[model samples]
Target: MRTFFITALASILTFPVIAGTMDIRVLSDINLSSLIVSPISGQYAIMADGQPVSDSAKANIFQLILEGDSIVMKTLEKKIGKFAKVIFTGVGKNNIIKIKSVVPAGRIRSYDDHLEVSVYAAYMKVINKVDLERYIAGVVEGEAGGVTTNEYYKLQSILCRTYALSNVRRHELEGHQLCDLVHCQYYRGRTTDADIISSTAATKGMVIVDGSLNLITAAFHSNCGGQTVNCEDVWAIPLSYLRSIKDTFCIRQPHAKWKRNISTEDWMSYLALKHKYPVEDSLSFNNAVSFGQAGRAVYFKDKDIKIPLKTIRGDFQLKSTYFSIEQRTDSVLFRGRGYGHGVGLCQEGAMNMTKLGYSFKDILVYYYKGVHLVDLASLEFFREE
Candidate 1:
C-alpha cells in the first residue's frame, strides 16, 4: 500500500509499540455460536461486564453462548448471568486455557494470557490476549508445520514479529490487533514444540527494517521457483529491499514445479471472452498456443495482444504467474513454476539454506536486499535521538 517508499517510511516510524500482551481474535474465520473454556495452567479469574461474578472461584469449566446482543456465561453447576462481555484474565505467568467450540463443532485449542468473549451479530466473538512471543510461536507453528531446523523457525519468528509490529494498526477499529487467519498471520494457538518456543524466544525483540529504520512488510511465500521477484512486479510498488534475486536453494524443494492441462478450445474461448483476443487471426492463435518462458514474463505472448500473467493465474487457478504453454493435440499444457506470489522470502529456500548451516541473518539478508536486522528497542531509541 506504500506509494513513495521514503515518504511512507516516515509515517511507519511513528506507530506505537504494542508490546507485552497482544489482542488477537481466535477462530476469527469461524462463525462460532458456543464454546467450552477450561484453564490448563496457572490461575484464572472470570469476570462478567467488568465485575467479579459469584461463580468466579474454583471454576474449572465455563460455557459461553451468544444470546442476541449479550453473552450467556455459565458453569457446569449454575448460570453466571448474561452480560455484554465476558472476560478471562490470567493471574500470573504461563496461564493457559483450552477452548473447544461446541456450536459449530471445532477442535480444542490452547491459548495463553487471557480471553474476551462477546456477541457480534450472529456469531460469538472470541479474542485471545496473549503475550507477544507466545503469539509469534503460534503463528510460526501454524504457518510452517513439521519439525525442521531451529534456524528456519528463528528466521520465521523475526518475519512474523516484523509483520505484526508493522500492521498492528490494521484492525484497530475492529477492537483487536489481528485475526487468526491468513489475512494477518495463521495463528492457531500457543505452540507446545520446544524448538519453536526456543526459536521464538531467541529472536525476542528482533525485526527486519529498511534503511529508514521502518519495519519492512516481511512478505514470504512457499517457494519462488528459482528466483524471487521484485516488489513492484507483484504489488506495483518498488521497495528497495524487495528487489529480485536468483536463489538456487529452493530449486529442488517441493512446490517448486507444477503443471496443469486445459483444452485448447477452452483456453481460446477464455482469451476471446475475457480479453477479446483476436481468435480469427492466425498469428495470434499460433502464438497463444505455443508459448515458452525462459524467465518470468509479465504478459503472455499473443502477437500484438498483451495478457497479464497474473490475470491468467487467477482465471485458470494456476500456482504462479511463471508458466509456459505448450500446444498438445487438443489440450494446452500449462507448465507452471513455483507456488504463491513468487515474491519476498521463499520458505523452502530458507529451510534448505538453514540445513546447509546458514544463519538466520544470512538467509534473511540473502532474500531481502539492503535490509538491516535491528532490535525494536534500538529503533525506538534511534527515533527519539
Candidate 2:
C-alpha cells in the first residue's frame, strides 16, 4: 500500500498552511483489514469528514476525498433515548462497517485499540480488552488528567511509529510489499485530518538515518535504563543519520515543570504520607535515588568502542557500569541512566524542558541533533500540481 506525506494537521499550528506528502510504512498491526469497529445498534452511521452519512454509500478503500480532509466514521446510537456517537462501526460476520470515507474504497483508517490512541491509533496492537478499557478509563476518568499540552501528541507519535515499524513487511523493501507502519520508518496515512497530519509534518524529513547518513531503518524506543544505546549496538543496525559517537553518554536533566500547584516540600510530604516515603532530607534523596535509578541499565557490549561518561565541566569521569546522577553545580547534574526516551530527553527530559523555558520545538532539537526545520509548504510547493 502507498502512504501519502503528512498534512498540515501534525505540524503547523495554524490550519491553513500548505501541505507536504511522504510515505509511511504500514504493518499488520493496523491494516485495512485490521480495524474492528462495531456498530452500536442496528442502524450504523458513517462520517465523510465530520458530517453524518447514511448506510448506503460507495465505501471502497483509498477513496481520497481531499488533500487534507478525511472521511471518518462514528456510530450514531441512542443514549438514554437520545442518540450518542459511539465506536459502533457496524461489526458483522466479516466484522466491518459500510465505511463511507472518500479517501479510497478499500483503504482502512488503521485504527485498533491501545492506550495512547487518545491522540492517534498507536494503540492498535492491544494486549487485551480489559487492559484497553483500563487504559482508556485511566486517560478519560481524569485519572491521567486532561491533556493541557502536546504530551498527548508526543505519546501518540511514539505509539503510531512503534506499531507501523513492528510489523515491518521486509528488511529492505526488496520483495515484500511496501508497508505503512512507523516501523517501516516513514509515516503517511491514506486520509488524515489536521491534527494527525500536523504531528507527522512536524517530524517530516526527520528520518532516523544511520551514522552513514543512509536510511538506518530506525525504530524509536522508550527509556533505556538511563544509558543511551549506540544505534548500531542497540538495534544491531547502523543508523544513517545518528552517528556512532566517541561517547554515548550525554548529560540530561530531569525535566522540571511549572508548579502543578505543587511544591518540593509539600510534594515530598504527600509522597511520604500518601505513597510511602519518610520526611527527611537524606532519607528523601535516598528514597528517590534508591527508587529512581534502581533497576535500569544500558550497556554498549563492544569492548573496542568505549563510550566515556563525564560531567559537563570535564572534571568528573564515570565508570562503565550503571552511572548514577551526581549533584554538580547550578544544574545539580545528572550522572544519570538510560538514553533517549528516558527522563528529561533522557525519558522525562521533555517534561523538564516544559518546566524550563524550552518549548516543544526546543525539546525535539535537544534530542535529535543537527535536524533542520523546513516548512511543509516547501515540501508541497511543486507537488500541488
Candidate 3:
C-alpha cells in the first residue's frame, strides 16, 4: 500500500485538485468459467492483444472464456477466436459497461464505468475502473443497505472513501487497487438509489483521518449491541481513535442480540480438547460454564484456564465475543450481543443518530474519537490516477 502525508495548507483555494480513480476487481471471490460483457449505453471500444478490434458500436457484447493460461473473448451470438487480453473502454463519459456471469444463473451485475478483464490463476478477473465518488455510492448501497436518511448515507460514504483510499493497494499484486469482496469492501456496482448517490456526492472527497491527519481504519459493523469495543481488545492493535464507547442507539435495531444452543457434552468436550480445560473438576467447571458480561470480556475465565472470548466465538460460530454462557439441563446456551468484530462505528447506531437529526460529521465524531475530515483533493502528498 502507498502511504501519503498532508501538510496543513495555508488556504483551500491554493490546494491542487485531483480526480480520484479506482481499479477495483469485481467478483473477485468467485471463480467463473465465463462471463458476458456488453455496453449498456453510449459508445464502447474493444481492444485485444493491445490492438483495437471494434469501436463505437450501437450494440456490442462479448463472451470471455479461460483458455489454457490466457483469456479468450468471443461474441455471444457468434463464436469468435481467442484473445490474450481484452480491454473494454468507454468512448464517451456516458458509456456504461455490464458484465454478467454465464456459468451461474441469476448472476448479473452492471458497472457505470470501463472494464479490464484478464486471466489470472486460471480464472477471469474483471477490473472496474471508476470514479471515486461513484464507487463510493455503490459501496454505500452494498454495505449500508438502503439507509433511510441522507445523513447516514453520508456517514457511510465517508467511511467507504476512507477505507478505499487507505486500502488502495490491497490487490495491487493482483493487478487492481481493491477487490469487490468483504475482505476489501463489499462493492456491487453503481447504485440506483437516488438518495445514496446524492448523499455520496454531498460528501465528495471527504474522508476520516486521525488526529495526526493520517487516514483511520474506518472499521464498522452491522450493530454493536449497547456499546462498542476497543480495537486493541479485538485486533490486539491499539488505535488511539478506536475506543470503546456506550451506544444505546442500536439497542432496538435488528441484529442486536442473538442466541445459540449446543449440547452440554459437546461444549465441555470442545473446551477440554482445545484448552485442556478441567471440565471434570466440578468447582472449576461450574465457574467456567456460567458467566455474565455487563461489558465486553477479553476471555472466559477459569482459575487456571483463560480462553480468549474470540476463540470461543469462532469455535461455536457465535455472533460475537460479547456473549455469556448458560448451562442448561441438556444444552449450553450462548447468548451473544452485536454482530461482527465490534470495533469502531456501529452502523445501526449511526443510522439512528441520523434519524435523530445528526449530521455525518457528528455521527463520525461520536463513533471514531478524535478524527479529522479531510478533503482528498487538498492532500498535497496524495496521488491518484
Find the candidate with the highest TM-score and give its number: 1
**Could you estimate the TM-score for every candidate?**
0.95, 0.34, 0.91
Q: What is the C-alpha lDDT of each candidate?
A: 0.87, 0.31, 0.81
Q: In model 2, how large is the Cα lDDT of residue 99?
A: 25
Tens digits of per-residue lDDT for model 2 on 1-385? 0122333223323222212211222333432212333322233334433344444233322221121122122223311111112222323332222222221223333322210101123222111111211122222212112232344344334333322322334433432322333334332222224443344445443322212222222233333343444454444454433433221222353221111122345434544564454546584544333322344334311223222222211222322223443332222233444334222223343444555556655554455455433333443452343
Instruction: Report the CA-based lDDT of candidate 1 relative to the real structure.
Output: 0.87
Candidate 3 segments whose C-alpha is farther than 4 A from its true place: 1-18, 55-59, 76-80, 104-106, 381-385
Residue-by-residue lDDT tens digits, candidate 3, 32-114: 76888888876777788788775325337787888787776666555555776788888787778888887654367888778
Question: What is the overall TM-score of model 2 with all chains considered together?
Answer: 0.34
Candidate 1 lDDT over 211-244, as tens digits, reads: 7677898999999899888878888988998878
Clashes of each: 0, 73, 0
2 versus 3: better lDDT goes to: 3
User: Which regions of candidate 1 deviate over 4 angstroms?
Assistant: 1-12, 383-385
* Candidates in descending TM-score order: 1, 3, 2
TM-score of 1: 0.95
